[model samples]
Structure formats: structure tokens, C-alpha cells
Target: MTKQKGKLGLTARIFIGMVLGFALGLALHGFAPDSSFTASCLTLFQIGGKLFVASLKMLVVPLVFVSLVCGTCSLSDPTKLGRLGVKAIGLYLITTALAITLAITLAVLVKPGIGLELHSDASFKASAAPSLADVITNLVPSNPIQAMAQGNMLQIIVFAVLFGVAIALSGKAGERIAKVFEDFNEVIMKLVTILMNLAPYGVFCLMAKLFADKGLDTLGSLGKYFFLVLGVLAIHAFISYPVLLKLLARLSPLMFLRKMRDTALFAFSTASSNATLPVTLETVTKKLGVNNSIASFTVPLGATINMDGTAIMQGVATVFIAQVYGIDLSLTDYLMVILTATLASVGTAGVPGVGLIMLAMVLNQVHLPVEGIGLIMGVDRLLDMTRTAVNVTGDAMVTLVVAKSEGELDEGRFNDPNAAKAEEEVHLPHGHA
Candidate 1:
């Protein structure tokens, strides 16, 4: 325990790396554009960014597998998994719809779509959305291995719950399986700790590379639209989440936020919720003191389904693209945009380059130019980070809500401002033990 708590935790070091790397990136880009500098800076960028992401990815498969299995078996009654599923999906839908509504409402008032040049010449064809039949069929993978290979969250979830229930019902046989899984969970979690030790170097590189390539000018041109989306996300995160966590969950949002910063920064830098999954899982379980059972099940589902941030982006982008192309969308078109974005949030969420897909769907609905997606892709690298930050926030928020409803949340740790310290006490010594 002394060894565990004596040093700065992985999160603190990684944060320091990110800040230093980001500053170095800006400095290199601004003051040293020469070939040698560029070459040297690229090395720094790769060290901080690529390595961090790769290390994180290394944790993904193990983390998800172990955490999900453990989360599944820990349920008091395996049947409650069904109830948890319902609550999580329901909360996700309500929040997603609310998010888009808020974003669209703000867009209309802000008029972000008005007076933008709508480029018609760029030919961008959108892939057809899968039919409802296909969506349903894809949910239950016949081969679970194939599902994991595909990183299909919904299918992975269905299988994990089923596996756990099977174990729960089998008496002694279930105990044998559960014990094996528990050991595997420990092994995988240890792998996560090993990867975490490399976080500082990875974070430093990723942050530096991002600010170096992505300039403030990207935001300057679309400043209004940017702020509209940003403001909506911020309001939802700071204002909406606090009220819910404080009132409904009866926890201190300030304490939650302080503990959440390390994972939040990782999400902001990586821009992939899936990529951020390992860290998110660790943070929620260890720092926030959410039950591993809840964190494992809810966090992945949240990454896949709780796309309030993406829904908001789709809402604003639909308006922005419509105005850029001089397309005058009526009430029906706006309504369609809302419905389409809300639905697509679930379908296209785990898809890489989801922004393009969502934008494609929105443009097709409003008869805006599909190629308008390219206009935003340059700045999207940064915006992706922001949206991801919101996405994870939604994930943690919903997890807290469901945990509270089930009487699973650790209110004592959650209310303490130094929740991270409590987390170290719970998880750190366990590892050594």
C-alpha cells in the first residue's frame, strides 16, 4: 500500500505529459518549421500520440473481455442484467434525442447554416443505411469470435450477458466457470496496469501532434458554428449532468469531475470512445468507485449507444451543411434530420469516420451536398476530440444513474473530492495482493 500510494499515479503523469507535449507541439509548429525541426518534432509527436494510442489499444481486448465477464457474474440476480439493459438503453435514447433537440434548437436560433457557401461539385455518395431487418439480424452474432473480431459492441454485450447467465444458472458448474473468469479478470487488469505505466509518453506525443497540425484558424473560420456546438455540449455536460447526478444520484458532481479529468483528457485527445474504453473502464471502476460489474457492462454500451455528443454534432452539421449549399429546408426536412440523426447515432456510432456517415445521412435528408463533409473534415480532428469528451461524459453520467438506481453506486467515494485517493486504496493494493 505504501509503495502504491507513495508515487504520483499514472493519470497524473499522463496529464503532465499531455500538457507539455501540447505546448511543445505549438512551439515547434510556430517557431521551428525547418526540415530538421519538422523531423525531430515528428518523432516527438509519434512518441506522445501513436505510442499512447497503441498502448491503450493493447488494453482494449483484454480489458473489455475480463471486465465484461466479471461485471456479468457479479450481478446479484442475473435477471437484473435485463433490467439494467432496459434502463441504460432507455436513458441513452432519451438523452440522445434531448441532445439533438437542444443542438438543433440552438442552431436555428444561432442561424449557423445561413450564408454559408454550399459546394455542389464535390461528389460524395453516402452508403445506404441498413434496413431494420439487417440491424436486428446483426445484433445476435452466431459466432461470438467473429463478433469480437469485428468489435461489435451490441453483439459482444448480448453474448457476455448470456454467458454470465448460463454460469449463474449452472450451480457448481457456474462456480467453476466464474472462478476461472475471475482469475482471467485479474490477469487482464494487470495488463491494463502495465499499459498505464506507458501513458505519460503516449499522451505527450498525441497532444503535441494534434496542436501542431490543427491550428486555431480552423476554428476561426467556422467560429460561430463551432461555439454553437461547443456551447451546447458544455451546457449539457456541466449544467445538465450536475443537476442529474446531484439530484437523482445524490452525488457531488464536482467530485466526479475532478476524478474524471484524466480519462476526459484521454477521450479529448484520442477522439475514439472505443480507444478510450480501457482508460474509461479503469477510471470508473478504480477512481469513481463504480462497481466493475456496472462499469464493464454500461461503459461499452455507452460508447456504442450513448451518442448524445454525436447526435448534437449531426444536428448542427445538418443545419450548417444545408445553409452552405443554399438549400432551404422546411419544417419536415428539419424533423427528418432530427429523426435520422437520432437513429443513425446507434447504427453508425462504432463505425470509424462516423461523422461523414451521419453527415451523409443528414445531407441526403435535407438535399444538401454530400461532399460538404470534406469541408468539415479538416477541422474535424479537433471537433472529434470535443465530441468524444462529451460522449464519455454521457457514458459516465448514465453509468452513475443506473448504478444509483440499482443501489450499486459507491456514494461515499463519489461524494469525496479526493475520490482518486479512495480509488487507490481499493484497487492498488488489490493488484499487489
Candidate 2:
């Protein structure tokens, strides 16, 4: 492995790419609104951006399955998995509830949608949400292969955990298979490293296309909603997460935040938690010094279940939509919103357009017009990016706490400012190293 301390770190490079892409996109949107050159460049950016996102997603299934298997097999006491799951999921749910509560309180006080006249003609039709029974029944996959093929994370998680438990119970043969899984995990992580090295270009392309298509005019029209969502997201990331880390994990919140910059940037650029999984796993294990056993389990499960940021959006949007429609929500209605939104986080796991879908469920529960979804849909893309950053922050925070409680965390690495940067060095082949 060769360390290049003088070179710019990945976080700095990605940030630079984002700024340059935004400037370039803005220039084209302003000066060459309908030019063929702009269209061509935008097309190329779209292709690069899509390819990069697909590449990252391509790693999620194998990485999660293999890594989780390795982690489970490493356990000396199987009961510890039960304890770990309880702590991780409990922390995640608590944070989700807190996020939504904060968001609703802020949105109610600010009144972003009051006195605003948006087009009432816009209609939104929400898909039928599965009942709680359906959700629970569907968790156990009928076929693990089908689950993997469909990218059904909850089902895949169920299958992986059960399969891992089996492997752990099989004694000598289980140990041999576990060793093989460990090798697969190593290879998958190396693949993540290779893809991450390409993230600057991907982030640039994604941001350029995003800004080019949705210019400042769209943001201007929905400035209040935009800023409110952003403010809440910032509060959760900077304040909520840090306080939790300090109070529960007893680690330096500053160090944890410092290690998270690159991972958060990836989430913002991609705007998909599943797509950001590989980078998150790498960051949690290699940088934060969480053992792979705990990181593998907590991070993947958190991506599927913990959506504090999305919960925050739903809380704010529910209030904003109700205000826009001139409807007053009773205290009971607000309670229902909090309950629905918190449960919806797990209910909507692995579903596409998760934030909007959850918002629809909340609106329907409160007898609010579902069509009001259109009012906020225009700015959802921008807000989605910020919320995703918060979601991953929650994931990392929970991973640290779980790891610490289990005695699986390395405090030195957690406190090191240069931990992530040092780990980013490119490792060469055996002869070269």
C-alpha cells in the first residue's frame, strides 16, 4: 500500500467536482438554454451518472450478503446477534421518531405553506400500501435467489441472517464455509475501493445533469419549503447525531463527523441509500474502526429500516400540505402522523419513491388531500439529497454506538482525524507492495 498525503483527499476532490459541475450547469442553463451543445453535454453527463450509480448498486447485494455471512460466522455466541439487533433497531427507531417530531414542530411553527397558492389542478395517485400483516409475512423470502434478483433488501436480509445462523451451527464444515465467505467479503470490499476511486467523476456528472435540468427558477418558486427541509436536515445531521454520539457512545463527536464527510458527500450526490451502501460500509469499518461483523449487520439493516431524514421530510410535508389546503389538524391527527411516519419507515423499506409514498400514507391517514403531494414534488429532488445525507449519518452513528457497546469498536481509530484519509491509500499487488 502506498500513502500519498500531499494529494487532495477524496472528499475534497468530490466537493470540487460538485462545485465545478454546478457552475458549468448553471452557465449552460443561463446562456445556452436550447443549444444542441448543451443537450449533448447533458446526455453524456446523464450516461456517466447513471452508469456510476448502477456500478455502486451492483455491489450492494453481494457485499451485504457475503459480508453479513462472514460477520455472523465470526460470532462465538449466537445470542449476541440477538442483542446487537435489538440495540441497533431500537436506536434506529428512536432516532426516526425524534427526527419526525422535530420536523413537525418546526414546520408547524414556520408555516411554510400558509398563504401560498399552488396549482390545485395537480393530482397525485398513491399506490396501495401493504398492510402490516403483508409486510411481516413478506419478510421471509419464498426463494432467496428471487429476493437477490429483485434487490429485495428486507427479504435478502432475512435469508442472509437465517443462512448465516445455519452456517454458524454446522461446526467444522461451517468453519470452512465461513472462511470462504471471509474471502468473498474481502474481494467485495476491494471492489468497493475500486468503484469509490471513480466517484468524483460520477458525482460531477450527476450534479451537472441535476442542476442543468432543475435550474434556480424551480428552487425560487419553492424557496420556503426547500429551506425548511434543508434546515431540519442540517439540524439532525450536525446537532442530533453529534449529541447522540457523545451521550451514548462516549466518543468524540467531532472525530466521527470528520470521518463522515466523504461518505455523506457520496449520499448527497447519489441520493440513494442503497447506492451509497458500499462506501458507507467501507467508511464504517475501515475508517471508524468498527469491526466488520457489527458494521456489516448494522449498516445494511439501517439502510433498509432507518430513515430519519425521510421521516423528517414526511413530518414537515404533511404539515405543509395540510396548511396549503387550508385544513387544520387536530392534536389526535398530529399524533397519528407521528405514529404513521415512524412505522412507515420500516413499512416502506426497499420501496422506490419512499419519501413521497410515506407522505401519501400520512396524508391519507389524516384525511388531507393526497394531491398536495404535487406541491412539494418539484423540490423533493433537492431535499432528497440532503435527507439521504442525514439518513447515512444516522446509520454511522448507530454503528458506532452498537460497536462500542459490544466492545467491537477501536477508540483510537474513532478519535483519529486522519483515520479515513490514511485508509484511502491505494493498495498495490503483492509484488509491488
Candidate 3:
């Protein structure tokens, strides 16, 4: 399909939206300072952005369950599923470990928390973390419908895989059911296409409201902690992921990043990996050329478990909090922090405010006061957005590596600049609602 006259691509449009939104937000914050009109505009911005985020999130559970069921049932060998799981989870753990270690090394060198007062009225009550046995037992949902209702991703994934595997084993009956699922998958993807067309506007509102309220002011007293987190996130995204892409998948990192622009923007705007899963899955299978079989399994699982960005934040925050309290961490303490933060990534999966909770766990491991979490909470919103972008990028990177290892990657589509360009600009048929 040819490009429509005078219309920008989705990536370009989203970028424009973000830039314009940022400018408008900063302008409002600087000039209005306090005004009824400004408040109204911010309110409108918030509503618009939230609606977009909700729309994206609306697709996640169904998309994951449906797409994964389709992908799993199509597999020719059931054992390949186990191998795929092993590779994806192993890579996730390694990258998360690397992320925290990098954060700690950078933080120790920068000393972002040095000389800062440990005083704060910011108290935090950490929710008790579940044991490994609980996490493992909870993986098998007793009621799949209840799991779906609760948006319990791990449970949904487990149920979908088993259902798909059963379909694969059911012979003629399996084939008929699988056909129905395949049809449903297409419908779900069309829904995704409809959502993608709305993304630029959604992205604009999200950026505008975010900057309007949060503009540059939250950095005071926490500037070092804030930027260090951002810096490590960038390194993880630009440096670390690229190296892995090149080394493991032998794919061009530049091409991967270029293809990832839209998904990364969506992840950053929404600050939820689950919300970004539809876009990420689309980009992987369509633009990046990972077979749906692998992309389907890996993307949703990665969304749940792959939190390199959060791990990085926890790492830096642990060191920062320890330093603020003048508690010098021994070498063993630093090692413990890395191990705890990495494992906590999986252990605390799907919890609300998981980054802080994981940081609290890490803090306790090193005997640092948990209340120090309040010191860095003020600046977390912006950093959360950036790190989420990093998290999704890591997900895609691992997906590519695993897909390539399994011989499921299509290098032609991956290498082509315009592989999914026209597909992204979906238009409804005339007279269609």
C-alpha cells in the first residue's frame, strides 16, 4: 500500500505529539503557575491520557490469552515450549542481574546519595512479600475466569498455555478448536490496529498532563538520584541491550531500536509494561519478524517477569538510601543487594508499586531503613516512565534473541526498513463504524 498524501507515519506522528505536548505542558506550568484555566486544561489532559492508557490496557488480557493460545497450539513440538520458557526466563534473569549490578557500580562511583541528610517525613509501609512457595502455587489458577477478571497475568498465561497444549493434543477436535482460536486471534489483532491509530493523540495527552504537573520541579534535592537512574536506564537501553542484540541474535541493534520507536514511546507514555504488551507483541511479530509462536509466549511472560528497569532503580535506590543513612555497605552487602534485587524481580512480579517494594526488600537485606524509600518517592514518577520504556525494550531484545536461537526469526522482515510501515496506518473500510 502506498502512503497517503501528506500523512506522517505513526512513529513520526507520535514523536511530534510528544514534543508538542511537552512544550505545551512546560508553557502552562511556567506562565500560569496557578489559574483555574490551567487546572481545567490539566484536568482535560489527564482525562484524555487516562482514556488512552485504559484503552491500551483493555486489550492486554484478551490479547495475551488469545494470542498465546493460538501460538501455543500451533507448536509442532510440545517440548519446544519448555525450551522456549527456559531461554526466555534465563535471559530475563541474566539481564536483570546485569542491570542491578550496573546500577550499583554506577551508583557507588557517582555517590548520588553522599552527604545528603537522612531526614524525611516520608514514611513507607511495605506490604509483606509472598514466599516462593506461594508464587509457585499461585501460578496455577483454580478458576481461570476469576484470574482473567483480576487481570492476573501469570495465571492467565499458565491457563492459556495449558488450554493450547490440550488443543494441540486433541487430534481432530483440537484442529477445529484451534481454527476457531485462529479466527479470534485475527479479530483481536484488528482491535489492536484500531487502537494503534489512536495512539498519537493518546500519547500527546499523556505527555502533556504528565509534564504540566511534574515539570522539572520534582528534581530538587533528588536530582542526583533521579538522573543517575535515568542514566543507567539509558545505558541499559542503548548500550546494554544493543550489545546483547548483536552478540546473541547477530541482529543490527540500530535496526532493532529504530523499529522499536513506537512501542517504546507507548511504554514510556503509559508506564505499564502490561499496557504496552499489545504494541510490543505487534512490533515483534510484524516489524521485528519473530514468529508468533515465540513472540506470543515470550512477550507476555517478559511483561510480567522482565523488569530490568525496575531492577536498575532498586539497585541505585538501595545504594542511595544506604549512603544517605551513612551506612557503609560491605562488599558482601553489595553482593546481597544484587542477588536480592534480581530474585525479587520474579518474586514480587505483578504487585502494585513493585519497584519500591523490591527496593524495600533490598534495603532490608542490607539492613537499611525502609523509610528511606520516602526520600526518593517524589522523583519516581518521571523515572518510572523512562524505566518502563527500558523494560519493554529489554522484553523485545530477549524475544529477538530467543526467536533467533530457535530459528524463528525472519531476518528479511527484520532488516527491511518499511516492513510494517503501511500496516501500522490502518484505515477502516468506507461506511464502517
User: Largest lDDT belongs to which candidate?
Assistant: 3
Pairs with steric clashes in candidate 1:
48-202, 48-205, 48-206, 49-205, 49-206, 71-293, 118-324, 118-325
Count backbone overlaps in model 2: 0
After the best TM-score superposition of candidate 2, give how far the Cα of residue 286 lies from its true spot, in angstroms. 0.8
Give lDDT tens digits, candidate 3, residues 334-428. Answer: 99988887777776553235688778878888889999999988888788888889999999999999999999999999999999888887777
Ranking by TM-score: 3, 2, 1
Q: Give lDDT tens digits, candidate 2, residues 1-433.
A: 2335438778888998899889888888888978999999999999999999999999999999999888887888999999999999899999999999999999999999987888678778888766667778999999999999999888888888888889999989998999899999888888888888788899999989988877787787678988998999999999999999999989988888888998999999998889999999999998899998899899999999899999999999998988888899998999899988888888765323678987888899999999999888888888888898889989999999999999999888777777767557555578763
C-alpha RMSD of each candidate structure in angstroms: 3.6, 2.4, 1.9
TM-score of each: 0.90, 0.96, 0.96
- In candidate 3, position 336 carries an lDDT of 93
lDDT of each: 0.77, 0.88, 0.90
Candidate 3 displacement at residue 205 in angstroms: 1.3
Query: In candidate 2, which residue ranges exceed 4 Å CA deviation?
Result: 1-6, 350-352, 427-433
Where does candidate 1 stray beyond 4 Å?
1-12, 34-36, 121-132, 350-352, 420-433
Candidate 1, residues 314-391: lDDT per residue as tens digits?
A: 888877777777667788988888887777777755433576776787777777777887666666677777888888
Question: Could you arrange the candidates by lDDT from highest to lowest?
Answer: 3, 2, 1
